[model samples]
Target chain A: MRPIVLATDYGTSGAYVGQLKSAIYTVAPGATIIDLTHELPEFNPRASAYLLASFLEYVPPESVIVGVVDPGVGSARLPVVLEGDGYTFTGPDNGLFSIVARKLSKARWSEILLSSEPASNTFHGRDIFAPVAVQLASGSTPRLAPAPAEDRAGIQWPDDLHEIVLVDHFGNGVTGIRYRPSDQERIMKVHGEKVRYAPAFHCVGPGESFWYGNSNGLIEVAVREGSAAERLDLKTGDPVGFDAAG
Target chain B: MRPIVLATDYGTSGAYVGQLKSAIYTVAPGATIIDLTHELPEFNPRASAYLLASFLEYVPPESVIVGVVDPGVGSARLPVVLEGDGYTFTGPDNGLFSIVARKLSKARWSEILLSSEPASNTFHGRDIFAPVAVQLASGSTPRLAPAPAEDRAGIQWPDDLHEIVLVDHFGNGVTGIRYRPSDQERIMKVHGEKVRYAPAFHCVGPGESFWYGNSNGLIEVAVREGSAAERLDLKTGDPVGFDAAG
Candidate 1:
């Protein structure tokens, strides 16, 4: 059976995650559904994109990744599907898959249009993306739903590499560093200091501030015995570091 | 912050889940841990063992997975640190990692001996497994606390496959088949002019019933629109199946 991973801005508190799973099961009937995360901070598309893109390589190939961080659902923003590198992506066209597509190099994409039947203004997660993903998981052809849009260029990477997109549960601000640990020291400078690689999260002194390459392989600012995001008053999507270095 | 995922048999309503997370964060400051699941049924080691073995592949390779379904925590059972395939697994060594280790093939394991350190009889999940997992995530080597045990070859897989281990939220009985669609057809057998593979949960029709094959890739008896685990007298680790083919 094909594995389908769901990445969304929907938090676990609501029925949103459950409903989406139910819908996928309704259509696919026998699909293996795994939750990448439903607790992404709401409507943070870039954050959602970064999280999905960072973890995309680890999931099994041919896995259908459905990302639903659309604040622009039912609007002019297009719902699209991109097939590339032995994987399928279904989500909004707002640059969510850009990083992933860029990493994979070649992506076959098509903009999705719902049937002439009336669609809900809100909850496109349930109405649009979930059903489409279900069908796709069940081996339905992509051409059955909608035709491809004429212009399908990839999205441009954000100019600032040091921009923080997600502050996780421990309040460590996660950045979008498209660099490996070897190249990270030179690619970006943080807080007027060259980024240092600590052996582990608490390798630095207790309560002392430190910057290191995170497990996600990005430069992150953290505290040894406290919350860096909380103490620094950082939230998701806040830009950090000098623009010239990026 | 490092991400820690918990796989435990402590049901959600209990204080075990809360305490484990609390203890983890207490020791490993600035850590971002997540619950893979806390709803595992009681101390059913086979259930917890299989669930962890099946799901660990989907998570990031370096993730620290804490499995705590120890019925023999303070008893003769060994507490172990298993290092394998970019992942670290901590739990009671009651053959929980046996299936996982076999699946990964490259798994290198060592036993965690905390006997001299003193531990609680009832709650080794908090004192032993939880703390060890936290320390591991906080950047400690496995040798910090205990020396390795020589006889690490005794771990074994569950011999019986007919028992139902977990009934999911939908009342689908999660069975040993790890039910995939390919198993759907073979699930029903012809017995003396009788036919099976009917899509009903119980001996009913026109409503949701547990047949077989669920999202987890297991042979489950699931109620389509309701809870079959509730409707029929099924609970965690209950034996279930058709006596005769068809």
Candidate 2:
């Protein structure tokens, strides 16, 4: 069976992430659940959308990816399942899957029609998305109605965003801009600080700030042996600009 | 097959935790790996010890738990396999398993005689502990030599510690004290701030600080809808005191 990958904003703090796993394991004891990340920028599904999309290439094909950065958990947002390329995505309809759908070929969106009301209004990740993901992984058909493409959240969002989307534990600021080797000569500006390009950390001196194509194929700002987030005062949603190197 | 549970201080950053999972999957693709936590107090096995012990009652029986909070990864510390109660543990023998051993009846310690030197000195969690855990989970015997109890690190340490061992993402301070129903009347003091006892977070008003028995059965300090870590200026390793309430 394809791995059930969990991507959430639940920071692994309390019982929420554990409950997601328990909810999955309760039915499918043999299912393999991989935590893609639980520390996505909290409540900012727009930023999380780009970051989650960046990880799609690394995840195994045909995997069930559950992205739950829903700030509208108790609101009227729809729960969705989007089949992108060979992967199946489950999460709230709040544009979290928008970038993911765009990156994959022949993506299809569907609204999950629950068999019954969820146990809690505040935790659809455990109640709705996890069970739905388990059903997908187990090859069982869930009640899903075709969702219109026009109504999809973030459908009109730019293919690539130009803001810091995640600050990882190393203090590396992962921006939404895709990094290609062709753009090696460009300088990236964040919070008024100019960062030149480097292929990798060792290419730069200690404590020097630089931008690089991270392993996930995104432009990540980092300070060698230091915190780039601290040096540049960067956080998620901070705008980043690109310019030709002087 | 028994499940492999990972507890580390790797903090879900960078690629350490992912690599540990990959290492296990590479050997045992069917392994059910549960991340008990990766956010243990960094480089301090003494604190991690009490916290790991607190979770022992909750983990499934006969699970192979891999605990890696080693500050001396590349050093002379031995990689050890410890059996406590029915569960097997693999990690650096730097007192990470000390408290765990004390908690379980008939615990035994053995030095892992590696067939080859670990590929990387700094990441025994990936190279040593993960593989060892897979072997145990797969019902295979790893090459282990009996380690004397007298040579064990933290063998003579106190049964309980009086310090905050972990500050969780919710800003709740988890101390080393085991909470029982009898301790409800005791007042807890941390960093010169006195806190009363409450049955749980909901028992107190918003922003009111109190101490309670956490789900894991440890005394935790928290402020409802606020951060106890900030409210009491608490951090891991900060001393905590208990007194009878007037």
CA lDDT of each prediction against the hidden true structure = 0.64, 0.85
The 10-residue segment with the lowest total lDDT in model 1 chain B: B187-196
Q: Per-candidate TM vs. native? A: 0.53, 0.61
What is candidate 1's lDDT per residue for A122-207, written digit by digit as tens?
77777778788877776776544443433542355563355777775445667776535564344234444434445344356656
lDDT for model 1, on a 0 to 1 scale?
0.64
Q: Best-fitting candidate, measured by lDDT?
A: 2
Report how large a share of the reference interface contacts model 2 reproduces: 0.10
Q: Write the per-residue lDDT of candidate 2 for residues A6-82, one digit (tens) a residue.
A: 99987875445765775676577688888889898876899999999989888988899999987566567899999
Q: Tell how far residue A245 is off in model 1, in angstroms.
A: 9.8
Question: What's the count of clashing pairs in each model shown?
Answer: 9, 0
